[model samples]
Target: MAAGARVMFAPCISEGLLLRVQSLLYVGVSVESIMQRHNESVEKQGGPSNCNDLLTHSYVRRQERVIRRSIYELDADVAVSINMWVENHQSHVFFDEDFSDVDPLTLGIQTEWQLQQMIRFGNHSLIASDSRFRTTKLKYPVHSLLVINEDNKVIPVAWIVAPKFESSNAHKWMRAFYNRDQTKDPAWNLAGFIVDDPLADVLTISDVFQCSVMISFWRVHHAWHKNLVKKCVDNEMRATTSRRLHQAVDNICQQRGSKRLFEDFIEDFFDESDFVDYFKATWYPRIVFVVSDSQWGNRLYQEFHKPRAGVTMRKSKKKEEPVLEDLPKEYYDDVSAFIL
Candidate 1:
C-alpha cells in the first residue's frame, strides 16, 4: 500500500504530517489550502490514484485539536510570566479582576510616562475615547483613551482590552482609570469627551464624569453622506444635495450656525424627501448639543474645529539691477576697460 493510504488507514495521523500541518497553520495558511497542497504532493510522488481522499476533514480537525492543546500549554507559562511582570509593574498595569474570575478578560495598561503626560496635558482638555477591532487574532476590542498634547498631537493615555464595546464594558474600562476615589482629584478635570458612538461611550462618560460629550464629526458626516447616497436618485442629485447638507453640517459642527438655520436650510433645499425626514428624525435633536454655545459645542469647536496655523510660501521679489548712476566710479572704469 502507498504511504498516503497507509497513513490515512492508520488510527492516528503520522507525527511528521501533523507537524507539517501545524507549521502551515501557525503561519496563517488555511486548512483547505494545506489539504490541496498535500494532495498535489501525493500525486507528484505517485503515492495514490485517489489523492483527494488521502487528506480528510477529520485530519484537519485532529491537527486543530493538537494545535489548541499546544497553545494552551504555552499559554500557561505565558500567563505566569505575565503575572510576574504585572506584579513588578503594578503602578503601570491594571486588571479588572482575576483572569480565572472573568469569562472575557479586561486589562488596562499605561506607562508611567503616559500617566505623567496625561496629567500634564489631558486635564481640562478634550479627551477622546474609542474602540478598535481586528487588531489581534484574539478578536477582543481594544478601547483607547487619548488626549491632545500641547503640540496638538494625539497621545494615548490608557488602553483597555475588553470582550465587547457595550456601555457597561466602557464604564468598567473608564473606571479602571478613575475610580470613585480619584474622581475628586483636581487633575481629573476634563473639558469634554469625544466619542464615535454616543450610545455606548457617551452614556458612561457623561454619567460617571459628568463631562460634556462630543460626537465625532467624521462619524456624523459619514452617516449623512451614506444615507444621502442611498436616498438620492442619481449622482447629480446626490452631489447637489450633499453639497448643501455638508455646508449645513460644517457650520453646525463649527458652532457658527444654529438649529433654526439648519431647519430653514433643510426646508428651502429639500422638498419632503426620505433623506430629509431621516435627518430630522435621527439627527435633528442632536444638533442642540453640537451647536450649543454653553456646553459641548463650544468645547468641540475650540479643540477641533478652530483653524490651525499653516506655513505659506511667498513669491520671491526679483533683485533689481544696480543703477549706473548709483554704481561706484571703479565699476564704470572697469566696464569701459572691458568694452575697449
Candidate 2:
C-alpha cells in the first residue's frame, strides 16, 4: 500500500518541480519535454524508470474512479437523510460539476420546510445577499443569504444556486416559509435586508409578511456604481472620483450628523434614476438610516412628522389662555433592537 501511494504522488512532485523551473527559468520548455527529462533523471538515479509508467497505469485510474463513485454514493445517502438543522447549516453535496452559460451547476439539497422557516420567521434575520461565479465565462447566479445574529455577526441562512435570476426562484424560496396565519405577531417576521441589487424581487418578501423592514444598499456597491457613472478619463481619475465622493459622504455624515443629514445624504448621493427605481421597487418605504449618536434618534423622530396630541384647554374667570410650545420628542432608554 505504501509503495502504491509513493507511485501515485511521484508524478505530482515531479510536475510541481518542473512547473516551478519553467516559471522561473525555462519559459519555452514544453510539458512533454519536462516529463521526459524527469523520467530520464529518475531512471539514472535508480528511481522509477518511467514516470508515465505509473501515471498511465489502469489500476490507478480504476482507484480514482472508485473514489469518485464513493463520494457520489455518500452524497446520495446524505440527501435521503433528514435531521434537525442538518439541511440548514451545511450544503448537502460536497461537489457539483455541471455548468451552463446561464447558471453554474450546483449540488445542493434542501428540504421545503427548512426553506419556509428561514423566510417566514427570519430564522436568520440579519441578511446579506449577493451572487457569485467561479469563472468569468461560466456565469451561475449563485445567491447566498446570511443571517445576522445577536453577537453582531453574519451567518449563512440559505443559498439560491440556480441557472437564472428569475423572480420565481426567489418566490419559491419564500413559499417554503410563508404562513398566512402568523402575520399578527411582528416578532416572528423579517426585520431587514442588506443586498447589492435594487432588490426588486426580494422586497416582495417584506410585503407578503406585512412586516416593518429596513433595507439598505450594500455600501461597497454604492461606491462602485457611483464611480462607474462618472465616465472618468483614466483608471486613476476613476479611483480618485470614487474616493472623493466617498470622502464627501463621510464629511457630510460627520459634519451634519446622520439624522440631520439623512435626507440631504439621500438627495446628494442616491438621487439618480437607478437609485430611485431600486428604492421604489417594493414601495415599502422603510429604508434604515444609521445615525451617529443617540441624539440623532430624536432628530429622526422629528422627521417622522407624526402629528402632536391636542392639549386640554381651560377657562378660569375669563383669563387669557397661555399658548404652550410643542413638547420635544423624548428618547427611549430601551428601544427595540429588532433590526440591529
lDDT per residue (tens digit) for residues 183-225 in model 2: 3233454434434343335346555644333323233334355
As a TM-score, model 2 comes out at: 0.36
* TM-scores of the models, in the order given: 0.47, 0.36
Q: What tens digits encode model 1's per-residue C-alpha lDDT throughout 114-217?
A: 56556765565556565542446654467677665554545566767676555345676676676522543554655556565443445577776666665555
Compared with the true structure, all predictions reach lDDT values of: 0.56, 0.38
Question: Deviation in angstroms for 292 in model 2?
Answer: 25
Candidate 1: the clashing residue pairs are none
Best by the TM-score measure: 1
